[model samples]
Every structure is written in C-alpha cells, then in structure tokens.
Target: MISDHILLTLQVLPILPTLAATNLRQRISAFIHERTYQAPPDGHVKNVIVIGGSFGGYQAVKRLTKTLPTGYRVVLVEKNSHLNYVFAFPRFIVVKGHEQNAFIPYSGISKGALEGIFHHIQDTAMEVTERFVELKSGARLEYEYLVIATGSSSKLPSKVSSTESKYAQQELRGMQDKIRQAGRIAIVGGGAVGVQLVSDIKDFYPEKEVTLIHSRAQLLHSFGPRLRDLITETLTGMGVTLRLNARPDLSSETNTLKFWNGDEEMYDLIIPCTGQQPNSNIISTVSPASISKETSHILVKPTLQVMDDRYPYIFAFGDVAATGGPRMGRAAMFQADIVVDNIQQLIAGSRNLCVYKPKFWFEGAIKLTLGKNRVALYIQQENGQEILVDSNLGHEDGDVKSQWAFFGADAEELETRKI
Candidate 1:
C-alpha cells in the first residue's frame, strides 16, 4: 500500500504543477472578495428603477449601483424569480439535466446593499410613466430615472416556461416529455433557436425524423453566406430535412403543412421558433411615441433616451430598442454601457451626454454551435468582408457550459468575481 501510494502521488504531482497556477489564481481571487463584500438586500423603495433584469437590465442596474452614491435608491424589477439563460433553452427542451443550468437565482447578484444602492423586486410592470410605474400586483413605484429593458419573448421552451421558476421548469418538463415521445418533429424557421432545436433533437436521437423549415433559402439569413452554408452542411450531415425557400401554409384545423412547392407533411411535434416579440407593453402607457409602428420596438435617440426628447430621464434599450442592430448579448451590453455612462453624466450635473454609435458587423460578432464539437464563429473584417472562422470548442454533453460562465444570467459568486 505504501509503495502504491508513492507512485500515485508522483503521477499526480506532474499534473498538479500545470493546474496549480490556475487553481491558485481562482483561490486568491475568491479570498479577496469574501474578505470584503456586502450584497444589497432584495426589493426596496424606488429612486431609480430598472425593469426586466435580463442581460441589458442586469448590466445597467449593476453598473448604476456600483457607480451611484447613497442618494440613489436603485430598484430592479424582474418577473421571473431567476434569470433565464435563453440561449440554452433549446438544448434544455431537447435534453435532460440542462434545465438546471438555465435559470440563475437573483440572491447572488451583489455580495450584500449598503447606501441604498441596490434593490430587487420580482414583479411585472403593468404600466409605466415618467414619474412612476404600476406593478401587476397593483403596487406603484416612483422613480427619478427609469430604464425599460424587458427584452423579448417567444413560445415556451424556446424561451422560458413562465415568469415563475417552478412553473417554468414544469412546463419545460412537459415539453421534454413530448419531445421524447414524438416520432417526427417539425421545427419552423432557420433562425438560431429553430436550428439549435432541430440539431439538438437529431444529435441525441439520430433515429428520430427531424425537419427544419425556413422561409428563406439560407439559414441564419442575417449572417453572410459562409456561415449559413456551414450551418446547412452541419444540419444536412445530421440527417435533418431542410425545406428552404418554402414557407409552409400551416392549418391548425387539419394539423398539416402545405409548402410552396406543393409538398405536404405532418409531424407529431411542431415547434414555431419565429415571431419573437418585444415585451414593450409598458411603453404603451409611458411613451407611445417611442413605439415603432412598423417593428413594434421602442425607438430611442442616439443617446438611448426614449423617443420623447423632453423626458430625458426615461430610457429604453436591449431588445426593446430599435437600434437597427442584431439583438445579440454583446450588442445589448454595448447599449447598456452607453446608457449607464449617459445616466452618470446627467446625475453628476454634467452637460455632455455620451451617444451610442452602432458598431460595424465585424465588431458585433456571434458564434453558432451547430452541434456537439461543431461551432462556427462569424466575424467581419475591417475591409467590410465577412467570414465564418473555424472553432476548436469541443463542447460536449450540453451546449450551455461556456455561455453559463460568460452570460448564463446566474452565478452570484462569478458575477462580482474577476479572474
């Protein structure tokens, strides 16, 4: 036993040197934060209110809390008990265990609120105004500065099940059960969600028949050809039937689909990933002028202030803002930073306001995970050329790992931790 123990220790020692540096770094970083940190209490009176605590809302509120002083009583209102990692919703619907990683609790948001700097309210905003907002619970909150970052929503499983955490999980379970039992699955739209849904199903159940129908000839139509072509190849290789340039006229009564090419098909499971609508209902009361009649997105000035110039204190961003840009996480954060900076300027009694200029396509950038161990990074060069770069991200088991670490909407310890 002694001889074996010595051999094992020697074998582990060689590997320990490699991991020791990384582990030591994480330990040192954690030690410092634990020594000095206090999380703001949950839910409080409103001086500055932020609605919709997702990517844009969370970033905006966190930045405000870190920057604003004692006089500012910041409040964050979110309908969901936990922040939902929407990008992982597709995989969660098609698999098990992944749902656990999608919803992150709000309790870990700030280390603990000194100086009335942070508060959270798990409530829905029924209506909004320049002065106050009415909650669904019939409670009204007054605010000096208001930020609407409610983002958008799609069908269940594609997003979250509901605002309630338990109910949402139950809904996800039901969807997962349906997916397991269904013989043939039909996913409409070649957007990211739809593509991910079909791929996830096919990846797990190669025997199951899966079809992806997109109105456009290409997948991820917003991106350039190379990326779309790569996705098409990946799906085709995965045994997915792609119906491009064929907008199927769906009949709920008959439960059948008729394509433009006169082909008809039926499926045991039908998932419509299209029609992601903004949760801009609050703006209807506060600033109807900010609502775009065509797109239904809230219109904001270059400074990200609401369409009403006079009501500079009220603002909107994230997916709700009509910035004519892609609704990616990075883009939302960009808008959030500008909004927070501009808010700081005004709060400091400074006349100069920062304007939000949309970045070029290359600067925005997004990665698409086609399947396990298959990903393509879409980027634009300075010369206005777009390219889909190859990736070595061997993500197995679930597609939500890296995203959870980066923007999973949970991880209180990691939220304030830097490494």
Candidate 2:
C-alpha cells in the first residue's frame, strides 16, 4: 500500500521539470523587463494599488514594478510603516534586547530601478469599492487594478498587534520581563506558537515551571504524527509539563486558571496563544458576496483574482484569501508571483494568465526552534517518510540579518533603524 506522502511525492515529482521551467521563464521575463522597460509620462499613469505590505503584498509590488509595462505604477497602501517580521515574534517576546529587529523599515523598498514605478502610502484602508479605496484619513485612491493582501491578525506573541515599531518593541519587552519575573508560566494553546514559545521559555530559564495547555492530544495536528511525537518528547525532556485535551476557563482570575476537568492552578503569568482572524473587512464592506461564509476569508479564483466576476480587476491572496492551504508566508509569496504574472498579462491585453496551485508539502515545511540554540527542520521524504533534521545551530536574534539582506537592506540600516 502506498502511503499518502509517497503518493503526494509521486504526483509532484512528475511536474517538477515543468514547474522549474515556468519559474525560470518568469525570472527571465522579469529580468528582461527590468532592464529595458520604460515608463510613460508621469501624467498618464495607471495605478495598481496593493494593500498590506507584508509578505504577499510586498512581493507583488516588487514583481509588478519590475515586469509591468509603461504607463503603470504600483501604489502600496499599507497601514504600518514597516514590515512586521511575524516569524520572529515568538522568539522576540521571549528573548531580550532584539525586539526592534522584528520590524523592518520600508523606506528602502523602492531603491534602484523600482524608484519611479513605486509609491507607498502609510495609511489604513477604511473601505473598498469596485473602482477605488477610501482611506482612514478621507483620501481616496482610484485604481485600475487592486491586490488585497491584508493577511490576518492575531494577539501578541503569535503576532505583532501594533502598527508602530516602538509600541511593538515595548510589548515584546514587556512579555520578556513577565517571563523573566514569573516563576510559573501558563501558556494556553499548544499549537506552533505555544509550543515554540513554551520551549524557548523553558530552554532559557530551566528553573521556571512552564506548562503548556492544549485542547488537543497532539501538537501541530496538521503535520504528521512523527513530528508531533518528536515535539512532545522534546518538550517533556526540557522539563516542560504538557496538559492536553482541556481548555482553561477564561472567567477565572488573572493569576488563577481552572481547567475543564475541575483542575485549578495558580500562575504568575498566563498567555493565550490562539485566535486569528482574517483582515477582510474592507472587501466585505463593499462586496459581501466575495467573503467566505464559513472562514470569512476572501473568495479568490485559481488565478488569484477575486471570485466575483464583477471585479476581475481585484485580486486577493495571502492569509486573507481562501487558498485551501496552510496559512504560511511561503504560500503567500508563491501566490503573489502568480498574481503578478496574471496582472501583467491583463495589463498587456492578454487573456492567458497563470493560476496559483498550492504547493502543500513544500510550503508546509517548518524550521521550528526547540531551544535558543537548537532547532528542527521538518521535511517529508519522497517515500512517505516524515523526517526531522535536528540541528544545534540556531540564532538568538531570530536570524534577522538574513531577512535584512533578503529585503536588500544593509545590516547597518537595521542596527540604526533607518531603513
């Protein structure tokens, strides 16, 4: 009997060559356009406005500005002035002195050839219409095409709730101080965030009593059993207690928690690590039919455009789009590439557009930190085997330097917070 993993590998293996060629062609085309494309008169420009300047929206802006032809400019409407390094949030809240590194400045986003083709507005989108978007400051932006990449929202530790980097740093420092002072810490929700955070706390302060409370018997149930078992064993070995299959009564006092089975425990700190909602209010406000009734995510076609035929010019991706895959940064980037190509095709008067197919297994891979200096990269082999590649090499500052370089910024800029 062939396992599901093996079958998935077999299915994807046959198409690897095609996928590689397609990706190569995209790169070649983008390179050619980047060097030779010329912009038309400043007065005769059409806008391709993209909302939310995180993973998907940022990538879309980068690609569109490089590949789109003359007379088209990309207007990036982002609420935050900087890109929130969300992947580093779990570690930032636990570690000390590196919280500011989690926010990367956006000033350098339009350097080099991207200068004239890009314009960024640091404001929130209050409402969306078929033709334009209304901002919180009462300004309206008319767009020939729109990309909704508003992503999702979650509480601190799992995500940075503040738009301001200063406030976000303070919040993370506060959490770090709380973790430092508290002898007994209770972390609710044993998902990825909870697991990673609790492990960091325990790994950092071995003497502290860290308890992970989860509603399910397994950690990361979306992944395979081997990874789950490995995490369970690793956490248990680090002296972290696991309380499974129960939820805490939220009505209890700030320092006291009561479980469903009448179990009660007193703690100095209790952190809730669950609850994430899609930031699809702007789209839902005007086009209610475009939102999924069950998930509240925006309904998007395989081509990454809004499902509503009336608004073919509007597209949504990332967490806000119901892409039938794991909500991941990698998936968002992949979706953005396809959206960029489709938008370019539409701009060039071509009906042939690329569709976004979720690369489930590849995008689902996670490099989870077990401790400050230990990490595990989880991968699924071609023969249905889920393997965990454990490593001792890990970064205390969440390896933010690599991300700084990825954004084409100097490490010195990150140090000065000037980018």
Candidate 3:
C-alpha cells in the first residue's frame, strides 16, 4: 500500500512543474510587457466587465484576457482584494498559524503580456444597469458586455466576511480562538462546510464535545448513498455526535439549542453553516425577470446568458446562478468557460454561441477532510456509479501554499500584494 504521505504527494506532484513553468514565463513576460505594451485610446476600447473574483469570475476574466481581440479588455470588479482560498477556510479556522494563507493575491491573474489586457477594481458593485455598473465608490464603469458571477455569501469561516486580507486573517483567528475555548460545540448544517468543520474541530480538539446537526436525513443530501454511508461511519467513528433529521429552533437563545422534538442541548458555542444566500442583488433591480423567484439565483439559459432576452449580453454563473446543479467551484469554472466563449462569439458579430450543459455528476466532484490528515474524495464514473476514496492524505493547513502558488501568488508577500 502506498503511504498516506506518498498518496498526497502523488496528487500534487503532476501540477508542480506546470505551475513553476507558468509562473516563470509570466514573470519574464510581465517585466518586458510592462515597459513596452501601450494601451489603446479610451474611445477605441470596449470593456467586458466581469463582476466578482471568485472561481467563476476569475476563470472568465483569465480566459477573456487571453482570447479578447484588440480594442477589447476585461475589467474585473471584485470587492475582495485577494482571491480567497475558500476550501481551506474549514481547516484554517480550526488549525492556527495558517489563516493568513487563505487569501491569495489577484496580481497574478493578469500574468505575462496579458497584464495590459486586464484591469482589477477592488470595490463593491452596488448596482448594474443595461450598460454600466455603479460602484459603491461612486464610480461608474461602462461595459459592452457584463458577466455577473457574484457567487454566494454566508457567515464567517463558511465564507470570509472581509474584503481585505488582514481583516480576513483576523476573522479566521477569532473563530479558531472561539473553537478553542468552547467545550460543547454545535455545528448546524450537514453540508460540506458543516461536515468538514465538525470533523476538523473534533480532530484538533478531541476533548471538546462536538455535534453536527442536520435537518435532513442524509449529511450530503445531493450526493449518492455510498458516499453518504461512508461519511456517516467516519464521523461516528470520530466520536462526532450526528443528529440527523434534527432541526434547531431559531428562537433558542445563545449557547443553548432547542429542537421541535422537545430536545435541548447546551453548547458553549454554536456555528451555523446553513443558509448560503446568493449575492445577486446588484442586478435584481435592473433585471427583475432575470432572477429566479424560487432560489433568488440569477436565471441563466443553457447558453449561460441571462434568461431575459433583453439582456443577452449579461451572463451569470457560480453559486449565484441557477445552473440546476450543486453550487461548487468546479461547476463554476466549467460555466465560466461557456460564458467566455459565448461572449467572444457575440463580440465577433456571430450568432453562433456555445451552450453550457450542467455536467453535475462530473463537476460535482468533492474532496472532504474527515480529520487531521484524513480525507475522502468523491467522484462519479461514466455510468453514474459513485466512487469514494477514503484516505489519510489531508494536510493540517490543507496545503494552502500549493493553492497560493496555483494562483501564481507569492507566499512571502501576500498581505501587501496589490489587487
């Protein structure tokens, strides 16, 4: 059997060289291009503004910068100064000293000669009109085409609630200290965040009594039965009290949880991993018909363009779009590809455009960490058979440095890196 450390290395080894070569190439190109590259006259340039800098928006901006024709540029307006490593949040909030690494610099997003083709605006987009986005800073950006990948929002640690890296670091540290002091902790929600958080807390502080309460019968309701069963076994074995089909009454006071079944649990701390609301308010007023009445997610057609035909140039994806699939980073990246392609086609005055098919089974791939150095990877085969690989191959910091380098971000100087 391959050792756990070796298995972990095997997963990360293939990408290291590629990242290294790409980083070196970008650095050299940036040095030369920054000096030689000249911008077009303002009147000649057409802007394709991409809102949000998370996975979907990031992927869209990266592709747009490379594929856009001359006279067109990608303007990314993202509130966060850094590209947050959201997957590492569950671990970073539990493990100390690695919180600062969760935020990666966005400077490398426009690597090499593409630097001149891209612009990053670190500001909140308050509203979107037919041809302009109003920023909270009172600046207006006019765009020929708009890609809204606003993603989702939740409480801290589930999603970092800060726009700056320094504040985000403090958010994680505060959560970690809270978890450290709590003797009886209750995690509400059985989603990926809840499962990962409960397990990590238990693994790191075995002495603390941790309970994961899910309103549904299954932990991950969207996943297949095999993986769900395995997760149940793993969490049970870790001594994490699983309260399935358990709903915590919201009226309960602080440090105490009450259930409709007349059950009560005392906790020093209660963390809610539930309620991930889409950040779709920017376009809600401008294009009310584009928003889903049910999910409040921006409605997108199969082509990834806004459902309302009046705004065909507008595209939405990620957790904020009703893609009829699980809200995941992988799916967002896939959708971004389609959004970029279609926008490129439209820019070239072509009626032909790409459509985004929701490949959930494939894009739904997830890696869940059970405990310190313990992990589970879930994927579906071609025939729709689910496969779960349970292994002790996770890192305490969730390999934050590798992710930073993946974005071509410098680990030594993340705090001061400009957006």
When superposed on Cα atoms, how far off is each prediction in RMSD? 9.5, 3.3, 4.8
Please write out the lDDT profile of model 1 over residues 1-419, one tens digit for every residue.
Answer: 34423543443467567558845764564455344434445443437888988877877876676656435667899999877877777777777755665666665456443445677888889998669889999999989888889888777656864888778877777889999999898898889888878888898888999999999878888777767887888899999999888788755655478777888888888888887788887879767877999888999888888888868998888898886666887788778877887887888798698888766562367766666666666765445565555665746534554555554344554343223
| Candidate 1 segments whose C-alpha is farther than 4 A from its true place | 1-46, 112-115, 250-254, 260-262, 397-419
Itemize residue pairs with steric clashes in candidate 3: none
Superposed on all Cα atoms, model 1 deviates from the true structure by an RMSD in Å of: 9.5
Number of backbone collisions per candidate: 9, 0, 0
Per-residue CA lDDT of candidate 3, range 1-419, in tens? 66544544555577579658965764574466456545666677889999999888888887776667767888999999889889999998998877877888887686653545888899999999999999999999999999999998898667887899899989999998999999999999999999999989998899999999999999998888977898898889989999999998866567789998988888899999998888888898889988888889998898888899999899998899988766888899888888887987898799899888776655787899988998888876446666667888778778776877777777667544422
- Model 1 pairs whose backbones collide: 38-111, 38-112, 39-111, 39-112, 39-113, 40-112, 40-113, 41-113, 43-120
Identify the leading candidate in terms of TM-score.
2
Worst 10 residues of 1 by lDDT: 410-419
Error in Å for residue 407 of model 1: 6.2
Candidate 3 regions exceeding 4 Å error are: 1-38, 251-253, 411-419
Q: lDDT winner among the candidates?
A: 2
Please write out the lDDT profile of model 2 over residues 1-419, one tens digit for every residue.
77544555665688799879977997898788777767667678889999999988888988887787777889999998689888888898888878888888775568655546888999999889878999998999999999999988888787766778888788899888999999999999888888899999999999999999988888887788878998999999999999999889866657999887888899999999976899998987678999999889999899988889998899999999997756888889989988888898898889998988776667777789888988887766445567566778998987898987787655787777633
What order do you get sorting by lDDT, best first?
Answer: 2, 3, 1
The CA lDDT at 286 in model 1 is 61
Candidate 2, superposed: residue stretches over 4 Å from native: 1-27, 251-253, 381-384, 416-419
